[model samples]
Target: MFGSLPLGILQLWHRKFRLLTATLGIAFAVILVFMQMELKEALYASAVRYHEALGYDLIMLSPKTPHIVAARGFPRNRLYQAQGIKGVSSVSPIYLGQAIWRHPSEPLNRRSIFVLGFDPDDRGFEKLLSPTVLQRLRLPYQVSYDRLARPEFGPIGQMIDEGMTVRNQVNDSEFTVAGLHAIGSGFAIEGSIFTSDLNFQRMFPERSASVIEFGLIHLDPGAAVEGVRREILDALPKDIRVLTRKEFAQLEIDHWSKATPTGVVFGFGVVMGLFVGAIIVYQILYSDVQDHLQEYATLLAMGYPHRYLKVIVLQEALVLAILGFLPGLVLSVELFRLTAESAHLPLEMSLNNALTVFALTLGMCVFSGLLTLRRLRSVDPAEVF
Candidate 1:
């Protein structure tokens, strides 16, 4: 076994140029797979940014609402009704809408932004917005801009940080940037604005306070979330849907992963990367095997078993897998960082993703090695003589 392993290493080392080419090919595949998986994970993670930010035990929304960004208003009375439920501490109504954000410096350039409206005193936003910012949002026509918003939204966050009074048109109404928050942007939402419900209505006069987009329910201490969720669902009408905070977040994730084509596209990219890697490795392994058929035949003629020869090819694959995965991992981490900084996305290298790509690289190389075994098996010692 040891002898065959050395032979396999020697075979690859003998052709340093080919070995380098094969390692680079595998590295390219690793990078492709890692980038696609990271983006897919970021897509799901970013989709639930709002849900994760909200401090709530239970959430209520209209059943007609497909996702938080596309929320349909439910009667505000539902919040009052949920407040009367046992084990309920409080309920806060929130409003969501899309408005054209006129660039502060470029008036002609506009982009759609998500707007979230809630009461200033609502405890549900305590985790997301500081009390001071919430207080500032209480004033009409004042809104907090998301600091992680895409750069296309302009330098509103920078101006706010410099203590400048930044004002811009959100729809037909001009709103002042009172503060900045850190809820990042996603595929569907380029930027976000937070304002009090009063200001939200001011920006969209057609919407009524009686109709709100979401009802955040905070359960009393020691209240079971699942039990409270069940109670809320039973108490609410068919038009309303009740979910735990985790379930609410999952709902948004599902909408993006299942309801849209983005997830499918990313998944397809991963498959294509694997396919490309396998093909490249196969070509390299096949060529290496063909080049050394005479040496392999000599070994076979010496009574060496086919299994020993197989080990040599597999050993080369293992070496290639290791060499390729290291650089790919390093490059992927840097790319993830650059993407997170530029796009304001939640892209990062996780332990699971790293392990997954490594496994795929190993499997891809090993499979290629197995394919080359056919060529080795057909080599005739007699024909060589």
Candidate 2:
């Protein structure tokens, strides 16, 4: 069957000005959808960067621990019990807390910072922090500061690089920036500081040695993570929770995605983008169909089937999708880079994200075309004079 694609393409281009306007509308919609989704993804990516940097197979936490930022301490004996599991190799306790960082440079300025205390001997986080940096952390009051922490922390990273240990207040107690790491910032906190568990206790003397915030479980080679997780979950008391490192990271993501208002806002933005795009595309398609109604009526009188007209409209919609998507995709990539650099976020453009947005664009245009069909179907052959 000879289809109406050629005619559809010709008709769309015939009105060059309208065609350009429609194309721009579609592109705008694409950019909106792209940025909304990319920002949501970036939030999760940056939130989990800390977890991803750790070299551990399983993560153990207190059941009260909703997420890393609010982690509560659990009994150290639970970690010992985990080490006895069949596939278990070793378990390292990690202490987590928050402290007000009194800016060393500005006495009046202060901000909250995350604190991570781990046994220097375990070296569980050695993948992210070099041995030398971890060794430096062993010295009391000595701590490694995140290089990517927000500037409010008073140039802690720079001070460390210059071979100077700048003194600052951590929860009203004095602490030093002995080294620098690049763990990046999260939504709840501006930056993070790493130190030995002993030093951490020295800074926060209220924290007990018998309680730890997290337990990093390293399994023997070829160990089944799911099985170990189940084993640990069943063996541990109700106060403890055991999960694979991946599951732990997802726990943090899920907390941000569903448990917080930020997730709702981002999701709402995405939906609004789609709605805005659909409306714009529908208007363009409806206008085109209206302009060509007399011609469509004439064609129907000439015995062309209604399905042929539908094909033409759909082809036009698809063309708009492709043309709009190309520029939108390019713009989104550049925007993602700018966001990552300027905002110090981990925003990225992945193939999956691209494919997802492309599918949404196609659906948006096709749905718009469907709405335009109402006008096409109403064209009566007999109405044409």
Candidate 3:
């Protein structure tokens, strides 16, 4: 075992450039896998959890159909009904819509935005924010714009900060930006305005059929959410969907995780990257094994156990894993930053995610080398001669 150390080192030193290329190829694949998975996770999280940052304990939405609040919506009366449920502390009715904004004075470019309708005094409206934000958000005729919408508004924070009004070309006459919000880092409900539920209806005259887009629920202290959820679901009309806040979040999680094209495409990228990395590592090590067969045969002829040669192969795998993992980890971090900045998605790379990728990379190398050991089993001393 010890004798093979110098031999392995010498072989690596002599063939450093070729070996480096293969190692980098595997590392690059590892980086791609990390980027794909983390981007997918970031997109889903940004889509679903942006509101969770508001810190609401329960969320209610239209039961007949499902949609990400940021993407699609439905009209409903359940917003008020949720307020009336037992063990319910309060409720806030939200009207969601889309519109365009431009600086009252600018290049005069019309920009599109997402619009949220809410109440200033509702108790549930305050659950997701501090009194400071609530006060800021309640400024009369004001709407709060998210990060993504800031540009269309003309300048990110200040444009919305100074205040601007939005016209419901379709519904209400005119509305304004109440304030700007930072619900979570990276990406938000951008290019949008907030308005009173009344004003929302004014703009959406056709909305007599749907009172509020959704309702936010706050339970009385110590209330059982699951029991209340069941009670609400059973009591409500079939068209209304009722779920605990946790259930609602989980439902969104499951929906995007399993149903979206983005998730599946990224998942395929991860699997393919892993397979590609494994192949690269296997082929590189296979080449190295072929070159060293004579040395290995000499050792076997000298009474060295076959198991000892196996240890050398395992050593090479471990060396590659360590060398590759360090750079792969760095690559993953850089990728996360670039994606967050460029994609405008919240791609947070936790230590666990990097660690998981590192572990997987190590496993792939070891398994690849181990399986390719079949080459050693067939090497004959006579062939080497």
Candidate 4:
């Protein structure tokens, strides 16, 4: 193995251009795979963030909903079932839906916005806000919105102050912006205006309050979540599914991974990376074995075992893998960062992900080395000369 490392390095140096090309191929594949992983995280994070921003530990939705990340919606009526579970503390049934907010008073500024209906006086409501929010809480009907999405909405705390009731001109009802809250919005929905359940349902009366969507449940301190989860699941009717925080999160993530085009596209990239790596590594190693057939034959003629040649090839392949994967990984980190910043999406490069890449790269090298076994066994000094 030791001897083979120098031999592999020397050969790679001799075929610098080919090595460069193969390395570039590997890098491109790694970068794409990394991007997909990041997007998956973002998709999951965005959904969790929406709920988590409310400072809840467990989220219970209508039984039929697979996960929040997928196409998720409920009648806003099922929020009642989760409100009575044991070990449960504060519970707020929320009505989440969308409607156009025509700032009748502002004219030209009418825009569609998200509607979150929660009790401002609910016991757990204070846990859900930032200091900025607590300060704005005194303002009637105030809500949070992200600055990045609504640059025109003025600064946080700035009153878009002068607006008439939120007319779901389509539904023909009205609500007013208490103010906006900043839980954030990106890719999922635009952030502009927000209002409390009292105001929200009034404007969108065509919507329901008791027909609340999902409920955010807070577990009593030191409680057993698994036991509590099973009890909750067993208690709920089949029409609704119950998931613990982690299980619910995973389900949502898997649903998005399987159902979305972005998921499919990224999956293909990972497969292609493995395929390209195998092809390039196999062709190069096989060609090198054939080129050096004479030298291998001479060694065999001098009583070297055929297995020695195989060992040398395997070692060389491994060394090449380490050589290539190290640089590819380092470069991938930087490339992923640049892609993330420009794309404005989270592209996480987790340790597990990197290790998976490294393992795949090494597997490709081993596979490529094995392709030379038959040729190595048949080498003859006469044939080479």
Q: Give the winner by lDDT: 1 or 2.
A: 1
Ranking by TM-score: 1, 2, 3, 4
Candidate 2 matches the true fold with a TM-score of 0.91
- Highest lDDT model number: 1
- Identify the runs in model 4 with alpha carbons over 4 angstroms from their true place: 69-88, 100-114, 123-128, 131-141, 148-194, 219-242, 258-265
Model 2 pairs in collision:
none
- Minimal lDDT window, size 10, model 4: 162-171
Q: Which is better, 1 or 4, measured by TM-score?
A: 1
Instruction: Tell me the TM-score of model 4.
Output: 0.77
Tell me each candidate's TM-score. Answer: 0.98, 0.91, 0.85, 0.77
- Winning candidate number (TM-score): 1
lDDT tens digits, residues 206-262, model 4?
665566666777789987777777777788666555566677667766666775676
Flag the better candidate by lDDT, 1 or 3: 1
Please give, for residues 128-190, the per-residue lDDT of candidate 3 as tens digits.
444665565555444555545434455546544556443223223445544555543323344
Model 1, residue 331: distance off in Å is: 1.1
What would the per-residue lDDT of candidate 1 be over residues 1-385, giving only the tens digit for each residue?
Answer: 6666777788888999998998888889999999899898888888888988888888889888888888888899988998998999999999999999999999999999999998898778887787888989988799999988999989988898888999999999999988888988988888999999999999999988899989989889999888887887898788899988788888888888899998899999999999999998999899999999899999999998998889999998898899889988998899989999988788888898899899999999999999999998798999976
After the best TM-score superposition of candidate 4, give how far the Cα of residue 383 lies from its true spot, in angstroms: 1.9
Q: Whole-model lDDT for model 2 versus the true structure?
A: 0.85
Q: Show where candidate 2 strays beyond 4 Å.
A: 1-3, 84-87, 162-165, 220-236
